[model samples]
Target chain A: MAMIVDALSWVFLLTGGFLGVSGGIGILRFPDFFTRLHAAGVTDTLCAALILLGLMMQAGWGLVAVKLAFIILFLSFTGPVAAHALARAALHGGLMPLLHRAEDDPSKS
Target chain B: MRHIISLTLILAGFWLLLSGHFVPLLLGLGAVSILLVVAIALRMDAFDHENQPLHLTFRFTPYWVWLAGEIVKSNIEVVRCIWGPVSAISPTRIHLTATQRSDVGKVIYANSITLTPGTVAMRLEGDQIEVHALTRAAAASLQGGEMGRRVRELER
Candidate 1:
């Protein structure tokens, strides 16, 4: 059971690290500022969640695990709020996202 | 009244969890601090249903689980778009009608949309939310109304 927990923790940590790096690549690869928010969102939400969950698993059932859970809870709450604020600020600052209109795609009616 | 009680209990639990020291002196200090915080909150008129939201506790667990799954799914999609091709992402802005009755529910709906990668709820005015999706597929998924419906359920 201990070994299994350790294995699961490593899997989570590694996947989270990979996703975090993917988010970085996304920020560079995505065309515009608004699009980059999505990439950063990936790191804030799932990547953070995975890393914290992995740490919680390694900590096992204790106050340490409880504190980690609280961190996850707070991160999920604040991450999106911060993202929304950034997106809104950019929009209000007259930075228009390069949008793909439904008319632009001939395939969609 | 109920909100105050719930807030007190939550703060107490939070204090205990953070401190982890059961010594009488520390516990007494924790109690004093929690009471002080709660009193300040009450004075500030912050002990309301909207802020405390004790009613949502039972229902929130299931909603949170569902949201975590949605986040993971969208994360994978966004990651793919990152690695696959720049042309793969459409970057569309769409308007969504928030069907939730209360401010809390509407906020939850908007945040859940933003929480899922590949989409960000940019502007929320009254019953309408302006969202930017990384791809047309993400826009289509938000148009599905399933997540919005689930958030509405929490209000009831």
Candidate 2:
């Protein structure tokens, strides 16, 4: 049982580390600010979640695990709110996303 | 009245769990601090249906689990796009209909959209939300309405 838990923890940790690096690469590679937000969202959401879940497994069933759960809860709430506000502000400031088709305008009636 | 009690209990539990000091002085200090915070909340009129949201508790857990699955799935897709050619990303802007009836439900839907890695809810106006998706297919998946349907179910 201990071996299984250790293996799972490592799996989650490694996958999270890989995703975090990819998200960083994505931010650099993406064309515009809006698309880059999607990359950063990857790091904040699933990457953060997996890393924390791995830590929780290491912590076992205790108050430390509970605190980790709270961190995940707060991140899930704040991550999107921060992303939404940034995206909203970017749009309001006239930063247009580079679309597959330029004619497909979101602001047009 | 109910919200105030719920808030107080939650605050007390949080303080106890965080502090971990079982001494009498700490307990008294915690109680006093909780009372002061609750009093401030009352003065600010923060105890309301929207703030407490006790009605959605039972239903929300399942929705959250489903959303976690969605996040993982999209994280994989976005990661693949990241590692692939830049042209692999479509970066499309689309509008989705917020099928929820209440403000809280709509906010949840929009936030859920934004929470997923490949999509961001850029603008929310009445029943519509403007979304910027990493790919056109991502936008199409959202239009399928499974998530929006789940959010709608939360309100009931």
**Candidate 1 all-Cα RMSD:** 3.3
* DockQ, each predicted model: 0.65, 0.84
lDDT for model 2: 0.91
Q: Measured by TM-score, how close is model 2 to the native structure?
A: 0.94
| Model 1 Cα lDDT, one tens digit per residue, B1-156 | 888898999889999999999999999999999989988988888545456666688789999989989999999999999999789999888889999998989999999999999999998989999999999999999999999999998997
Q: By summed lDDT, which 10 consecutive residues of candidate 2 chain B come out lowest?
A: B46-55
What is the lDDT of every predicted structure here? 0.91, 0.91
Model 2 Cα lDDT, one tens digit per residue, B7-122:
89889988988787889999999999999999998878854535566557667889888998999999999999999999999988888899899988999999999999999999
Reference-based lDDT, residue B18, model 1: 92
Instruction: Give the alpha carbon lDDT tens digit for every residue of A25-52 in model 1.
Output: 9999988999999999999989998999
The best candidate in terms of DockQ: 2
Candidate 2 structure quality by residue, lDDT tens digits, A15-62: 999999999999999999999999999999998999999999999988
Give the poorly placed runs of model 2, Cα more than 4 Å off.
A106-109, B46-51
